[model samples]
Each structure stands twice: as C-alpha cells, then as structure tokens.
Target: MATSMRATINIARGMDGAIAEILLGAVKGQNLAAERLLALSAAEAPLDSNSGGTLIASGTVVPAAAVGDDSLVTYDTPYAARWHEDQELVDNLGRHYMGDSNFQNGRKSHYLVDPARENKAELIAIVAAGVKRG
Candidate 1:
C-alpha cells in the first residue's frame, strides 16, 4: 500500500488586498517624490523679472491618483506653455520690467522638462522603493 500527504498554504493576504497595498505604497511614494521634482523644476525654471516672477512661481505638482494615472508637473501661468517651449518673446519680456524683480541668473530654458528627463531615474527609484518584487 502507498500513502500521499497533502498540505495547504495561506497567504498573508489575498491577491486583491496585496495589489491594493502595493498601489497605495506606489501612490504615496509618487506623491513624496513629486514634491522634490516640483521644487527642482521650479528652481531650474527661467526666472522672469517681469510679471513679478509668475513663471518661476507657477511650478505645480498634480499627484497621481492610481498606479496607471500620470502625475502632472505643470506651471499655472497663461504663458507657461509658450515660455517652456522656448519662445523668443517670453525671453525678451523679462529683465526688471517695471514692478518686476531684477533679472535672475543660473536659470535655464526648458527648465522643467530637462530636469524631469535627467531625474527620471531618481523618480523611478523613488517609486520603486515603495514596492517589493515577488
């Protein structure tokens, strides 16, 4: 005669629960990282002495709600998009215009985009830090 043994294993949580946890962690991590990215991009943003530095001050981060959702990093000025696109007019409009602040150096055009691209790796790392590979 031959005998067989059977065993059962219980996961700490169900698949759906595990997935939800991971998504929560990722969302939190993304939000945490978004702050730093926003700050960096803002610092890199072209400083417009005109309009009281509106472009530099408009850097914003709209965080992701879910794993598949994209977190928006944007500026909230009317000319933000045009300025970011490196339009010549945006450049000439600055430089201590009337009530605006003095011209600022060390800022660059395409400021937000460039920093985001360069720091992509760091962003991913920050996101990854919240999840564990199974």
Candidate 2:
C-alpha cells in the first residue's frame, strides 16, 4: 500500500492590490515632477530671433506612469536639436554659419539644464509635495 499528501498555500488577501495602488501613486508623482521640469525648462529658454518661435514652441514633456514607460522632455523641432547640441547653423542670409566665428560662438543652450539647476530646491520641494499627496 502507498499513501500521498498534498499541500496548499494562500497569500494574504488584498496585499497585491495594496502594492499595486502604492506603485501607481508613485508613478503619478513622478509624472507630475517631469511635467514641472518641462514647464520650467521651456520658460527659461532663451529667445532672441523668435523667427517662428519654434524653439520655445517645440518644448514637450512625456510622462512615464506605467511599466516600461520612459519619461522625457524634448525640444523637438529640427533646428532645436542642432541648437541644443551647440552646433553651428547657417544664418538667415545663408552667407555663413553661426558659431564658426568668434563673434557668433557655438555655445550650448543651457535652457533646460540651467533652469533645472537654478530651481533644484524648488523642484525638490515639488517632488516632496507630490510624495506627500500620494
């Protein structure tokens, strides 16, 4: 004769649900932070020519609030990329490229970075507030 035994296990009820809610709250907080950064960066961006106001208009923020979601802020116009990279560009007259000569220097537009640095404290506060709300 032979005998067999079976075992069963059960997790605490609502544990997974509680954990999921906590995670979702954190994600929402992060998204709010990203949005704040994007707005600050755009506001601080330099505007001289304002030809099409494309540089300022191109500012955007992508919120990450789910698994595999990556947050990002971007100045998405074609020239915006070059400007952000500190690359030289031809003048409106197409005579010469800016930043090649000393008069027109190719300098990194710290539009996003500068604001982030200047408002580090404020941003931290914002994040803290978000956490508290969450």
Candidate 3:
C-alpha cells in the first residue's frame, strides 16, 4: 500500500507583490551587512599569530544577496582553519600552540561574530535606509 498527503493553503490575496518587495529590501539590507562584515573581519582578524597567514586570509563573507535569504551569510574557511581559530593543539614534536588565547577560551579572532556585534547599529541602519528608499 502507498499513501500520500497534500494540502492547499491560502494567504491574503494581492500580497505577493508586497511580500516580494519586503523580501527584496531585506535581502539588500543583508547584503550590505555582509559587505560590512567582510571588510571589518578581514581588517580585525589576527594576522600575526598565524605562521602562514592562511587562516586570516581565508576569512570570507558569503553575501545573502546571492542566496536570497537574510540569514545566509556564510562566514567560512578551510577545515584546518578551525584549529587556528579556536583550539590548542599539539604538533608532531609534542609542542603546544595556543590559538587566540587572548580572547575567550572557545573563540579566537571572532572574524564573524565580533564584526556583526560591533556593526549592529550600522546593520540596522542599512535595513532602515533600504526601507526608506523603497
């Protein structure tokens, strides 16, 4: 036996255009925030701590504009970068290296969160500016 379920739902009529406009504005705001974060994170990331600079250099902000979602700014780096950002590790020689020990124990450089927090007001302003312009 096989079973399937389907449902139809209705939102208020004539809301499509309004909803699309709101979504576009939100996306624009998100893109602006991503741009700011990219710049701030790159500038603030600890460069001198890494031997090769790959960790700081790999920092990136994937703008929500490309993904069409406000929450989709993907701050990313290579897999090994996590150890550089947040962990104390032992090398083959049994030497311990502290990764960003100056900050919180679990966080290093905070390339993403710190910038977002520091620029919260500016991010809000970007949204407001977009709304006003629209």
Candidate 4:
C-alpha cells in the first residue's frame, strides 16, 4: 500500500513561494534567485478564537546537509540572513497578524498555504487564501 505524510510551509505575498519550497527541500534548488535561501512568512487560515495557523518570514535557511550537529554554516545573500530561533520566524509572523487589533476586526487579507511530502518529497502545493484580517 502507498501512504503519504505531509509537511506544510506557508508563503506570504512578496515572498518567493518557489524559492521557499526549494529551501525546505520540498523542491529542488536549481536556477533559484540566489544561491542562499531567503526568508518567508507563514500565516493562520481563519481569524477566530478556535482557528490556528502560521506564517513564514524572509530569512536564511541553511541546507540540512550543510548542518553538522552544532557546526556553523555560511550564507551569502543580498539581505543578511541572521540566525533565528528554530521555527521562531514563522510563529513571530503569525503573531504579527493574529495579534493586531485591526486584523481581529474581520478585515480581509491573504495567506499562503504550502503542502509537501512530510518526510522528503519534491513538488509542493502552494495555495493562497483570501482571509479576513486577523
């Protein structure tokens, strides 16, 4: 039997979804804008007390292969990609929208939802939803 596991990553406007998928290993890295990975934003699906989601912000993503335990890696990009807390950038961007008063008031906006193979699969689905602000 064939089974599938999914890993998701969200992308916001102005964020390169293709490049993001590549960095996450959801897609391959070929002819990408920069040799270095750029940051992206994650967001929640709906704005409600019970609704939950996340957004990814633009930042540097080192290839998993380049990481060696606690060893350091080098990145070269136009925008300096600083070291960020693990998955913290995603959480932070989500908070930026969810925590805003105007967003909570039902204003409409958009968020990107990306789906891919859970463990390691190429080809991803990037869907953008028109959401009410918040």
Candidate 5:
C-alpha cells in the first residue's frame, strides 16, 4: 500500500515581487541601523584626555543594500584599532599605560561595542521602523 498527497501555494502577487519588496525594506532598515550605530558609537567612544579629535573624526558607516548584507561602522585613523580594542589600557609590554591621563567624560574602551550592546533595543527599533509586515 502507498499514500500520495499533493499541495499548491497560490500567491496572488507572485513570490518574486514580494521578495523584492521585502529585500528593499530590509536594505532601508540596514541603512537606518548603520546611521544609528555611528551616532551611538561616537557618544560611547573614548575621547582623548587632551586633543579629543582624530579617531572620532574618522568614524564612518557603510549601509547594506540587501537582506543578509552587513552594515559596518569603520574608523580610518591609524590608532583606531588600538583605541577601540585596548579596554584595559595595557601596552604590548604588559604594562598599564594611559598616556598622560585617562579618557575624558567617563569614556572607556570598547567605545563601539559597548554602545551597541547597551542600546541594542534602540538599534533594533531604528531598523525595524524601516521594515514592513503584513
């Protein structure tokens, strides 16, 4: 004995057009997310106790163009990596170093990471605002 079954999906508007609309919305959401991320990262970014420039000035965003795409925030300064990664203020020699003074305005390391983590809900909301659902 054997059993057979058949089913069909009747999409009134067709799947390709629907998928395209969703993808377009997702791109818009990603763009909004990138912009918000830049702002959040800037505020949480550790400012130099002295000049308080350069690194912050190099912040930028690359918005996504489709679903599953990446939205990136980048820093072009030479010391951007050092500043963003050195949470403990320790040098390669295993010595604690904070230059002349500590970061100003209560700012610390992981400037970009911390902000994204702390304000995750807000970031999601920003992106979700651009997406639409039935």
Candidate 6:
C-alpha cells in the first residue's frame, strides 16, 4: 500500500529554515504565520542565510507528510521580481534536489513541467514517491 505525501523543497543557497517550516506546516493543514514567510530577497537581489542551512520541514512528520490520494505537490522555483534573472540559481536548485543524497532513496520523482517546452525553466511536479518517515 502507498500513501501520497505533499512536499516542496526550497533551495536558494541558504538555510531557509522559516520557509521550510511554512511548507511543513502547510502539509499538516496548519496556517503559517506571516513572519515565517518573510521574503529574504526582492527580484534583483538574493539573500543568503547567516547560519548554515539544512532542509527543514513542518507538519505530521519531519521530512514526510501524509497527502490525499490525489493531491499534487508542485515545486516551482522561487519567484523573484524578475523571473529570468535567476535562471542559474533555479536550475541548480532543481538539480540538487533531484540528485541530492537527502532524497535519493525510497521516493520516486519526476519533473512537474518540462523546461524544454517551458521558458520558465523551473521544475514542476509530474509525480512523487510514497515514502516512510525515517
């Protein structure tokens, strides 16, 4: 048997702990506070965290959440004031999340949208894997 889980990984060269918390919380059906999502950067400029950032999550389980049978979890690169300006950053985030050891085992993954057909060049979710909390 398999259970659906919804997740979004935000990678921008920093911890993004608060943002992770928001995503985690959202999965658990919690309403996140405004401060939790405070933008660290505008469109032209990006920000890095002062502390080393590791992936953080909110909700029922730390890294995994129970999703509805048909829920779709989408991962769109962070939208900035100017979309095209951060192409490299977005690309790197997608590659790292897909290739990173943190997510390698257990779950199956796929690109939500093909970058080849889309100028957005960000990852969109086509499918996700069923995973157990470690």
- lDDT, candidates in the order shown: 0.73, 0.66, 0.62, 0.27, 0.77, 0.26
**Tens digit per residue, CA lDDT, model 5, 102-130:** 56786766888888888899888877776
lDDT of 2 at 107: 27
TM-score versus the correct structure, for each prediction? 0.73, 0.62, 0.58, 0.17, 0.74, 0.15
The ten-residue window of minimal lDDT in model 5 covers: 97-106
Off by over 4 Å in 6: 1-15, 30-134
Tens digits of lDDT, candidate 3, 1-134: 89999998776775887767776777777777677776766665544444645555665555665324554344345543454356777879999877655643233455667777988899888876765554
For model 1, how many clashes?
0
Superposed model 1: Cα runs more than 4 Å off = 1-6, 88-103, 132-134
List clashing residue pairs in candidate 5.
Answer: none
lDDT of 2 at 119: 81
The digit string of per-residue lDDT tens for model 2 on 23-125 reads 6666676677678888887665545364635677878778785845766878877766555545476668887555422212232366677777888887677
Model 2 residue 36 distance off true place after TM-score fit, in angstroms: 1.1
Off by over 4 Å in 4: 1-58, 66-98, 101-134
lDDT of 1 at 39: 85
Report per-prediction Cα RMSD to one decimal.
Answer: 5.9, 8.1, 12.0, 20.2, 6.6, 21.4
lDDT of 6 by residue, 86-121 (tens): 223335446532232222222111222222234222
Evaluated at residue 50, the lDDT of candidate 1 is 62
**Model 3: CA > 4 A from native:** 1-15, 48-59, 65-80, 91-94, 101-108
Compared with the true structure, model 1 gives a TM-score of 0.73
Sliding window of 10 residues with minimal summed lDDT for model 6:
125-134
lDDT of 1 by residue, 48-71 (tens): 666667886777789888888777
Distance from true location, Cα of 58 in model 3, Å: 4.1
Backbone-clash count (model 3): 0
For model 3, give the RMSD to the true fold. Answer: 12.0
Worst 10 residues of 1 by lDDT: 95-104
